[model samples]
Target chain A: MLIYDLFKMALRSLIANTMRTFLTALGMIIGVASVISMISIGEGARQQTLSTISKFGTNIITVKPGRKKTRHVSSDSVQTLLLSDADAIEEHVSLIIGAAAQVYRPAQLKFGNKNTNTTVRGTGRKYAKLANFTLDSGRYFTKEEIISARRVAVIGATVVKNLFPDINPIGQELKVDGNNYLVIGITEAKGALSWYDPDDQIFIPVTTAQKRLFGMSYVQSIDIQADKIEDLEQIKKEIDTFLRIRHGIREGEESDFHVQNSSQWLNSWGDAAKTFTYLLGGIAGISLLVGGIGIMNIMLVSITERTREIGIRIAIGAKKSEIMEQFLIESVLISFIGGGIGIMLGILISRTVSEIGGWETIVSTQSILLAFGFSVAVGIFFGFYPARKAANLNPIDALRYE
Target chain B: MGQLYLNLSSESVMIEVKELSKTYQLGKVDVHAMVDVTFRIDAGEFVAVMGPSGSGKSTLMNLLGCLDLPSSGSYFLEKFDIRSLSPNQLAEVRNKRIGFVFQNFNLLPRASALENVELPLLYGRIQNSHQIARDSLERVGLADRAMHRPNELSGGERQRVAIARAIVNNPAIVLADEPTGNLDTRTGDEIMNVFSSLNDEGATIILVTHERDVASRARRIIQMKDGRMHQDILNEGLIA
Candidate 1:
């Protein structure tokens, strides 16, 4: 028989039971929708994290005191770094832009009748440029101010809001730890990253923090900026060697400090995001598999119910292959229609999520094709056995079937 | 036209069977359904096969229809050996050369009369089947009911539709298995008259029935008993 006739016959039969067809197709619709929405959510989160990491400047590297061999070592607990070490690295390292020493501690600030407890970050003059911190008003501290151990502060937006709600923060006197300090600058708000809010801290000169406030000669960490992103690995190697020799750590002994770059953070976060995407897709894939099984189940039942029809066709002259083709086409048609609706619904769900949930969702062309192709394949794979069963039926027995 | 039916009978021999035997295994013991049954049918002959239940009439019909292969037999329709042909080739023979009418009408309940009659032509891969199906339905005096489904037709009308489907392909032989068994006496006579007219137009037909009056309508009668041929009679006086 011609394929056109077979297709028409299959269509007629499927239309005969419209409600059952739609119910069977519902499984496919839900499977594709969930997969698409879940994948979109994962992709959105990954891009957001990557953009935030890029904001830190990929060329920047952070050097913290003590290695990561032991977990949870705070900057105060380990002080193997010094301000001179930051100067030495800045002068000696090739492809290096500059370096800034940093030490932070929680302190109580009092301004007028308002008092707020906030973290105070003490760093060198070059810290603002190295950390991507921009001034909202006024200027950052000068090198002379750091050398003289001046009690100067650069307040963040959150600190300003808390301590100087009605007053201009720059040039204002703020008492920190019972000592008077001049607010020289107010940095731009840099939004929260996971747990820490960069806009909640205040910056001060490193010399004043070590000499007067903490009474400690050692620095906590150093921020190093490189001229180019590609030179980060080389600069990290140079700093490691220089710090190892400066700290008097011999060969085979673990280094006393840790050096991390923005790219490493970018890679780990990207990997984590990819894993989450696949995990969700895998779960949704199971539902799709179940949907395929449903198609098979329906096809089998349809065959049994139409046994007399099959026998009549066979008696008239339908080849076994032709009968098989008829049933197979019926199943494929069901899934094809279902998959089409699913793709549209999935894209709709993805758009809805982006609009309502405020997350980044990307519905890629590749994912759409994959889901569509998989649904068709599921139909074929699951439809085979039932079609074969129909074709192999004995005509005599089938004709006699009630 | 009359020439269409006349052209099919030009070759003379329609079906030839020699020592056709079929055996079935019911559990463990072998059951001989047909023991060396032999027969020959000529073109445009109206023959009746009459037998009681379990006398192997259905088995003989199945083998002749090419729906099943005989256990040991050499059967020929025109020139092609039915036993030597592959399953696909046998299906082609059935599609192009044979048509069947069953006791239950066996018309697809979902299809209209036109579509049901178009089935044989469709399987034969013939083009322009719509007009051909209409012409075939008109032959059975059912052109006006072409769009009526099987359920909408009376028993006699449904049987006429089956006859239309059988002759739509213009096959070399038509096989009717208890074609009028489910109808009332009046409806059964009406169906038999349709068959008689088709036979008069030079169409070869083989009818299987247990009713003696139904068998008397045929020009030739073959009676079966205990899987063996009991009698073969040429009823010249019975032909109208």
Candidate 2:
């Protein structure tokens, strides 16, 4: 028989039972839709993460103090880091662009009747440049303020909103730890970074916060920047050696601090996001498998129902290959129609999610094609056994079938 | 009476069977359905094979229709040796040159009269089947009911439609196995009239039945008993 005739016969058979055909195709529709939507959402999230990581300065490195175990716990333990270490690294590290020591502590800021708890970080003038901090109002604390340990402070956007929502916050007096300090600047509205809200902190000169608020002289950690992004590793090595020498740690003794580069954090976070996307997509893939099985079951039932018809066709001189082709065409048609509907539904669902939940979603042509191709393959793979059974039927027995 | 002799040189013989026998294997035992059957049918002849139930009349028809192979002996259809033909070749011969009408009027239940008539032609390599199918239905007096499916038609009407389907391709032979078996006497007579008219138009026909009234309609009757041919007789001037 001609291919056109086979297609027409298949189409007519499918249309003769509209409800059954529709129900059979429904599985493929849901399967393709879920697969497309999940993959698109994963792609969108991956792009978002990459863009967010790029916002941070690529050449930045951070050195944090590891927890120290002392022989005896005492209030007068010797400090492992100081302001001199920051100054020494700036002079000795040739690849270093700039460096600053930061001392961080949690404190409550009181302005009039309102009060808000926020982290206060004390650092030198170069800290703002190294960390990509931008001021939204007034100016950062001057170098003169750090040398004199003057009680000047710069608040983040969230601190400005909480403590001085109705009034201008710059140059306003706010009490911190029972000491009064003037807010010299407010940082720009930068969203969350590394799960920490950059908008909920206050910045002050390192010497002032150490002497007046925390009552300590040692800095907590040092932040560094490289002149070239490629020089970050060399710069980190220099800072590590300088810190170890300054803290008087000898060879074979573990250093009290560790240095980390921004790329390391970026890689770890990228890996985590990839795993999360795979896990989510894997869960969604189960639905597609179920859908494929449903298609197979329906096709098998169709073969059984049309057994006599198959017999008649065979008796009327239809070749086995022709019989197989007809059934295969019908199966593929069902899945193709289902895949088309699924693509439309997936697009609608993706748009709805983006609009309602404020989620980032990207629907690509590759995703649509991939989904359609997979459904077609599933149709053939799952439809094969039923088609073969129909083709191989005994004409005499089939014609005798009531 | 004239003695029938084998004509070795006659190319006009439509069917020739010699010492044909068939035994169906029913599990461990073989049931002999037909034994040493010899017959010949010419083109455009109207003949009937008559027998009681289990007398092997249907088995003979099946052999003549090329639906089953003989366990022994030779059968030739239109000069083609049927015993040597494959199953697919038999199906092709059935499609192109033979039409079958079953006792139950085995018209496809879901298809319209026109579609059912077009079925045999669909398998043939004919491109103008629609017009042929319509003409065949018209010949069977079913043109008005061409669009009606089998379930919507009466027994006689369904038989006429099956007749239309059988003849749509202009086959060499039309085989009716108790074509009016399920119809009332009057309806059965009507169906027989259609078959007689078709045979008059130069189509060979073979009717298989146990009913004397039905067998009397044919120009010649061949009787069978216990898987063997008992008699072959011609009617001189009988009105069926």
Candidate 3:
């Protein structure tokens, strides 16, 4: 009736049938191992996504002029956002640390015999650091050049690679829409993102583009740099209110401009990653459930096989609860052993995945403990019915069993 | 091992049963396995209950061993009424005051001879069970085979180990069912001799057997037939 004696008997019986014990525990091992590896892999992917998103300067907020509310019947709006609005945001919004007002147009570039169509963005000197872009060589145009509407441009690597294959692009003459502009600098090469490629565009003074090239008095977009990442929301709120009042957009109506923050983009992608993580955990949990059912199946068979032995034990003086405890301990021990082995295997797999497969995998102790605890619970939960059946067995009937 | 109060002037009863009956429901009809079985066993008495197959001898043994609940009975082990006791209390009675030996030896096959003997004492919550088991094994003349598993031992040795287990807790009654049914004549006689010696040592024993030869060794015999007691006689005359 003592727990120690019951455990000893259970251990001896399990040892008597080593093959069955190991086979029963195999299900739990695979179940727990998958749970661990799946969660760790999911966590690693989420962290990777966060770091990749962080690379684009999450603090930067963009404002695009919306033509949806335009009453123009010319098929296109004449001007919705002016450069004065950009100056107002820079001067009035205290949370706005810096602003880059830009106008964009796709232009055909000409240099010697090579010509290619590329995006030409007009912006001030502050656009480089605010947009997290760097100059590969040469220098940015002076502030005086933008004030004087000088014909200067900063070419991108894709433009330079296509337009000047044999010649250095900086300080060279490049014709933009039949207007000659001196290339002041060459921007760094940036790979493509989900939205667009920065390396395929050229930068010019906004004044020059607005007065001479596009012949427009309005800016296309304004990229606002927050004082800090956390201040973007406040800056956006202040800008929204300021823009709404300045544009005479009534309350409760859609504004003629849209303020976009990196937080929204990160949250969308974060939600998807979180859903994927939960799905992986759920699928892995199903295996654990299957493992638990396998344990119960084997435990039932074991109880049936040991009917005579149980009869003998009951005859010798073991109580019903003692019998139940004996079998429950056997199952719990099986799962605990399997869980221990599974933790090791899962850690090994995660390390292999990270080291060899080059996919980041974080093996957290919390995840291991959670999976281990779940396996234990599975064991106890599934072990109950078979154990109770064993306990409730009539000793006389069991003794006479063949 | 704690105390003893014996009245030499009067008889000390170990087990008392009256109006005991057991019925089994076999699908639709109720089969009466034991019908009004009534008997009394004295302390230190060696009694054999003999019956033909299907005569309810095993059922009677199971009831006497506290392994089954009778359908209607006022059975008593010492002062405690067996029918009134809870299952847990019945288990305690079996642990502290009764021991059982089965025809198949019923030793856990994977365990050693010593472990088999230690089982009853372990359930009895006896301290120093290993040493007690070792001493029990020695009493059965299997001291050298203490570490040997049941499969490694001969049939006679396994039965000897079972006897050691039965007496390890020093119970007032030891119930053995067909102790030598599977053995040859010589080995059966040897097993019967062990039982006789255990009786000589003042251990009350109730043995179930169909063999007249095995039954004759006991100091008393109770014969059963058709789920009823046919005869109850003392074999003290033959022993004398």
Q: 1 or 2: which has the higher TM-score?
A: 1
Error of 3 at B215 (Å): 0.8
- Pairs of colliding residues, candidate 3: none
Q: Candidate 1: global Cα-lDDT?
A: 0.89
Deviation (Å) of B93 in candidate 1:
2.1
User: For each candidate, what is the lDDT?
Assistant: 0.89, 0.83, 0.87
Model 1: TM-score for chain B: 0.94
Candidate 2 lDDT over residue span A82-188, tens digit each: 78888888888887878899999899999999999999999999998887888888899888999999999998988988999899987789999878899889888
Candidate 1 lDDT, tens digit per residue, B158-207? 99999999999999999999998999999999999999999999999999
Clashes of 2: 0
User: Top DockQ: which candidate number?
Assistant: 1
DockQ of each: 0.72, 0.32, 0.71
What TM-score does candidate 2 get on C-alpha atoms? 0.83
State, as a TM-score between 0 and 1, how close model 1 is to the true structure. 0.89
**Of all true interface contacts, what fraction is found in model 3?**
0.84
